[model samples]
Target: MKPTDYINEWVNRITPYSPGKTIDGMTKLASNENSYGPSPKVIAGLREKIPEVFRYPHKNLHVKEKLSEYCRVKPENIVLSNGSDEMIELIIKAFKGPIASIYPSFVSYPIYAQIYNREYISSSLNQDFSFDHRKFIKDAWKANLMFLCSPNNPTGKVIDVADIEEVAQTGKIVVVDEAYFEFYGTTAKHLLLQYPNVIIMRTMAKAFGLAGLRMGYAIADPELAEALKKVRGPFTTNYLAQEATILALKDLDYMKKSVSRIITDRKAIEKRLAEKYKITPSYTNFILADVSPMSSKEFFDRMLEQKIVVRPQPKFNGFEGNYVRITVGTSEENFLLLDALSKV
Candidate 1:
């Protein structure tokens, strides 16, 4: 038999995640990447540290220490990864005995569960895409790990604090993915003090503008953090990425400016889309537009023709229907997307 026969059933059963396209020869608004680049200090730090890459990363101090100081968590409470994507994998690998996250949150959550051969129990969102914790809590005891993405992807909505606390009280490990936290200005990091089962993940990809560097981390209780560490491969984060992240954190002013711009631009985009296209508002760095006027595939093709790329969320096999997720971009790029939409 061929090697394909040897593959695990779950591996064969899994559907690969379709991410936002990179802007190779076009302006990309498909991924919610920061329009502004990373901090100036980050570039300078990388340049200064280039010579040290000849040696293996120290892996014990500096980067973690800086992160600890910035996040106000103990150094032992942190686990570094190539990106928050790896942390999602680690959580599933470490604690997923049966089930994982509900549906329509991060697409990767279910993918991670499938990779671990766990049964994914997907709870759907309401008509408005806001999470209903009551439904998830009712089924919580069945899962050892539960993934919650605040300011959830695609829908760009968040779960309230009270709802998150109730889920955390269920005694299951809760992985709160705060990938879009900077744009929304809310987080469950504070809840960790009361719930040892809670783990908050943050990424440098979105607001921090380090998507290329692949730096992400998790903040959790010391014991749970150690459990995740056991599953993570050594040196998942490289020496340059670590050093660049340190500088990313050091230049607080630069990060603040970028976040401020996103917040402002997000509001403007919503206001204009509402007035012009009659579209609804989104809470995260990206917005989901109802594509009922045209087929999602057709609309996506039109956008591409205008040299713009956006993600079309396929409404197939129990997934939401007729919607596309558009990332918030720079003022000029955002206008270009609007211009394309107006024409179509």
Candidate 2:
């Protein structure tokens, strides 16, 4: 008779994804967002599109065309979504089979798989968080869908392209989440041509500084792209998001400049943090450091007392010791963070 009884048993067992917390006046470096923000042109353009909100969003043709050029794929090979998160869900919904990914990678891969009631499998990363392709391939052999994150979340480590190729050889639907590709400057796009089963997911949230607009896309073979379009809800991407993405794509230079700055700051933070903590080399705008000797929660709480926020990675599978993932903020914010770390 209870509403809970109506839910499937599998759905009841799922643990939802937890995002970083924010407090007023705190320097939030928890979530890996572009702190530099979007380009001036995108802001100006979005203001112009406000009055047009009365109308339904048009088909994603213009955005798709621009992204096609940006990604060097045909327009038909692209599918737009609310964000890359939705694209992940769509892929899970459209495909049927066990979902697999490496442990300590993107949390969404397994989380989404559970939401859709699909079997989720995972392989553990090496002690240093380095991925072993052969081990992953063997473990994920039974999976029909595989998700891989390069410049992986939390750790900011990139998967080698050769390892990606070896996984794609398994012939499963390989999803390469390149959400932070702009910072890393490499992609698995080359495999898309050779392997029709490959899907490359990207987002405007990171380097583009359009996290508020929630725009993401995927590039796949035209047939697979069409299938994803069928599964995704129509009008999921709104007018403002579409227009903002188009504007962001046009101002590639601004994004590149922001990325250059973040990368610089990322290195500075890594160098400083390495003096104490064991810092992992990063290709993205964030750094993961082993805060051993202090529990991750204790470190997080100490940062909190200073009104600074950073992500603790205790819940992620394969994380051996106390670790925290710090997003690279502006110069001022980074200075504040370092000052707080020293005092803590």
TM-scores, all models, native as reference: 0.95, 0.98
Query: What is the per-residue lDDT of model 2 for residues 153-226, given as tens digits with 9 covering 90 to 100?
Result: 87789999999999999899999999999999999999998999999999999999988889999999999998
Off by over 4 Å in 1: 276-280, 316-321
How accurate locally, in lDDT, is each candidate? 0.82, 0.91
Best by TM-score: 2
Candidate 1 lDDT, tens digit per residue, 1-344? 88888998679888898778886888898878887879877887788888888988775478889889988888998889888888888888888566656567788888887888887887777766767788887766588788888888877878898889989998888888999888888889999999999999999889889988898999999998889889988878988888888888889799888888777887877776665343546667788777776777887898899999988877834644578788888888878877887777
Residue runs of model 2 more than 4 Å from their true location after superposition: 315-319
